[model samples]
Target: MNITEVRVKLTEAKKNRLQAFCSITIDNDFVVRDLKIIEGYKGAFVAMPSRKLADKCPKCNSKNHLRSRFCNDCGAKLNDKRALGESGDESKGKFKLYADTAHPINSKCRDEIEQKVLAAYKEESEKAKQPGYKPPAMEVPDLDFDEDNTNS
Candidate 1:
């Protein structure tokens, strides 16, 4: 898939690992939002959008994040080892508490996305150092059709 456009919004907190938020337009048709530019040990990398993994509390039947020590609703003690089993290979530090909402199926696609996103992030960062730089708007325009405004 061709990356038609990439937009980056730099974060204010310089100390944080999260450097920026980005969105990409694929083939000028599909849009994916909330991709992150994170400062890893090696360098900056793009992280796909993901959501916290959660499971229901046995006691209260309330949903709780996999890493949660206690249930949000019932406050019952949760099994800390629960996520360890669900996520594969904790010994290798591959334990996951979040699941990617969208991701590339292969390494080539992933590399393409990462390269494009990081380049945009670097460009945005340089722009921020300019005299009067404004962050790019990350909002996607509404595409919904209104029946009243439609032409017959």
Candidate 2:
């Protein structure tokens, strides 16, 4: 059977009975009663029928996993498989890389992400190599900003 819609109400902090009272409308309009919300070691998750994700592999049209890349049933690569720059070659397929830069966050997202990743990597690498190294004391620099330099 297939579930059409799922509505869950948040309990204060029931722990086990987490997503208390979920209303799931199943196939033929008959709702399945009281599906439990389970809390795992990692996090909370609600498991439903596989049909909720996909019935067949989109690429090969084989009924393997509802959500999977290559079909385990037929071993065919699914439809949405992508190769690097495969779309631009007319001999292959049309590929489009769409970017929406109007949003403020998109403008600096790549730079900000790269800076954070590099900082984390540097810190971890330094710690990993400093098993017997002595730590050097660092001095704080004066950070006063000059405001009069722009008055040309």
Candidate 3:
């Protein structure tokens, strides 16, 4: 009823999130079927058989494979030392989120970018509407006047 371990292939890939299938082995030595892979925040995560957080390292903040402890490069411990208290369930371990920079899918960045783009688009749309369109909405404006004009 949990994921014991996971294995993955390191591929020289391009931008966006890493998407792939994973095999989950239960405590009884029985394996779960292939799970669908969508763009994951980090790399791949196998959440069955036992409990594991894939590709999340707490030390140097570099994400790595689930089975890997200590950064593959910096040697910072992948699992946080504090996670030992989590009822022996590694999945419940504290995993500082590390977004994959080398490559990312459109999912994460899409909303942020879309929001900005939508805001810009909305601004432009409003600007375009200013030429002719009018809506029944209250407008709050701060006013300033020249002293010379007031002197009259």
Predicted structure with the largest TM-score when compared to the true one: 1
- Backbone clashes in candidate 2 total 3
Q: Which stretch of 10 consecutive residues in model 2 shows the poorest summed lDDT?
A: 143-152
Candidate 3 or 1, higher TM-score: 1
lDDT of 2 by residue, 10-116 (tens): 33344442333233554548654333233445544432211122346655566643334577777777544332243534376333222222212343643443233
Candidate lDDT (C-alpha), each: 0.79, 0.38, 0.37
The collision pairs in model 2 are 59-78, 59-79, 87-95
For model 3 the local lDDT of residue 135 reads 30
Question: Across residues 102-144, which tens digit of lDDT does each residue of candidate 3 receive?
Answer: 2214556434332333343344335544767543232212221
Off by over 4 Å in 2: 1-70, 76-105, 132-152
- List the RMSD of every prediction in angstroms: 10.7, 23.0, 23.9
Tell me which residue pairs clash in candidate 1: none
lDDT digits (tens) for residues 28-91 of candidate 1? 9999997777777788888787777789999999999887899999899998888778554568
Off by over 4 Å in 3: 10-12, 16-18, 40-152
Model number with the top lDDT: 1
Scored against the true structure, residue 103 in model 1 reaches a CA lDDT of 89
